[model samples]
Target: PPGFVSLVGAGPGDAGLLTRRGAERLRTADVVLYDALVDPAVLALAPSAHRFHVGKRAGRPSVSQRAIERLLVRAARAGKRVVRLKCGDPFVFGRGGEEALALAAAGVPFEVVPGVSSAVAAPALAGIPVTHRGTSAAFAVVAGHAEASYGPVLDGLAPGTLSLVVLMGVGERAGIAARLRARGWAAETPAALVLGASGELVHTWRGRLADLPGLALPPDRTHLPGTLVVGAVAALSLRSPHSTEAQPAARADARPT
Candidate 1:
């Protein structure tokens, strides 16, 4: 009998944010191929499962997508209950669709368990709502890695018209800011970079669009996974009461309009 495969979202590096269904899948998995960003606590739940680190981090030698798909198929064909776990929502730039397509072509049965995407969740956890009654009615989530591809998209949208959320953008912060400015986005538009959102080490840097390129560089210069939030919504922050980090104190550098 062919075994089943489950593509599960790990959710922005926070084990607590993981959905019950995702956890159940992990616990029962005969083998789990998980990403680097998955919280260790979550992985602990599947102690008995054979685990493989198939994560691809920026600026690092990592597993190729093709290899990962092959591993998934091979394991499932061996009648193992395989779980391909990823950070954030599987379909949101997580390459989950690609894997699913590969499995289908290989005649493998699979299921997808959705997890909260960092695009909206990160901003919300940092107290910035992607949509507000009067401030914003629509929001755009874009990948930050390819500025050229998204240039036309950004050019068409009027500045301050809606909220913009960028995932995996910390590496291209400068280029992203320059592109937005060239596209007529206001220099004073509020922008924020949230690191480790929904996790214990959460940190936020708030400023204006023009300042984003500089603010993106944290003191440590560690290439931490982050989400970039832009627009009026970025100016609003309501830190969760449960957050260990205190409320964002006024920053002399923040050019909030």
Candidate 2:
């Protein structure tokens, strides 16, 4: 009989956010297959487990998803408890479901342990409330990577009513804003780019939707992670001690004519 597999959420870069349940799974894991974003410190927690790095860096070559699947199945056949760690919540576009499906088809036993996903975690760590009374009533999370069509899901936003949070949206900023504007989202909506959230190098730059695409940014690409929060709640972040606090009012900064 094959040993079990556990798909674990490693949270955003900070190990402080690892779920207690995830840690327990790691302790029992015979081998740990972890993501690119998991902190090395957290990886140390499972010192006795055989560690395999299956990280996917932006713009860099990475292991094929099929190979990752084979690795998990091979380990399970060896009767090793395998933990497939991923950054952020496994259910939120982390593609954990696909892996689970693969494992199920192969007859592997597995468990899922949730962790704080960076979608909400990075925004909160930046003092930006994703939802607030009288500010944003609903929120949408999107991916920044190119699509089969126009690129990132920012096109789904209706424009003014809800807060929008985007992960992996660091690229193609200008085009994203253009599409959102064409879709009717106000160019005046306040937005921010917060990089390296929850760690010592955390940084944030606030801008109106029109200006966000052109804002100066940090040099780190794939290694430095970020979360973008937009809408009225974007304004409220100024009240927090850690917020950069110099954002222009959303309505005042409409897209240039």
Candidate 3:
């Protein structure tokens, strides 16, 4: 008999956010290859499966994507049920498409189980809505890992008409802010940095677009992935102050009057 593979989304750091179908795949997995940031609770779901860590991080030694694809195919050919667990939606900058193509070329049987992407969930959990009536009717999610990924977004999208959600952008935020400023965005435009959403590490920093580069994550939060929110919607917070989630921190110079 042949084996199977499941490309499952682990959501954005919270086990509770895993979809029902995703959970089912894990429960029956024979071998699991997971990302660096997947929540431990989610991995615990595949208690009976053999676990392997193949996550990649900036400035760290990690497995190559091609190696991961090869591993998936090899494991399946060996008659094992393989699960490639990734953080956030498999197709959202997670290199899931590449893996799927590899599986197809190798003639491996596989399925993709989509989960919540941090691009929207992070900002939403931090009280910033990407879209709201009478505010922003449109939004764009951009990958900030490289200059090419975000350069065009800043050049093309007018700051007033759209909300911009940037993932993996914390490292290049200063450059992003400079580009926005040069693009004629108001110095006081609302901006925010949302980190560790849907988990205890969650925290939000809200401030003016000019002050975005100065909003630093604390030492405990430096390793966590972040989402950058810019435009009018970044100013709105639906989460109540009494809510269980961490409160948003406003920059000293950009605090509300």
Candidate with best TM-score: 3
Question: What lDDT would candidate 1 get against the real structure?
Answer: 0.85
lDDT of each: 0.85, 0.78, 0.87
Candidate 2 segments whose C-alpha is farther than 4 A from its true place? 149-152, 220-222, 238-257
Pairs that collide in candidate 2 are: none
| Candidate 3, 119-238: lDDT as tens digits | 888887777889999999998988887878789878987766799899999899998999889988999999999877776677788899999877777889988898999999999988
Across residues 41-82, which tens digit of lDDT does each residue of candidate 1 receive?
889979989999999876789999999999999999999999
Residue 21 error, candidate 1, Å: 0.6
Indicate the residue-level lDDT of 169 in model 3: 92
Top lDDT prediction, candidate number: 3
lDDT of 2 by residue, 1-257 (tens): 56999999998867778889888888888999888878887898798899998888867888888899999999998999999999888887788999999999999988888878888878877668788878878888887656433443556556777888878777756767777887887878898888877665677778898898777686664357877777878766523333233321121222333
Q: Count backbone clashes in candidate 3.
A: 0
- Model 3 / residue 99 / CA error / Å: 0.4
lDDT of 1 at 154: 75
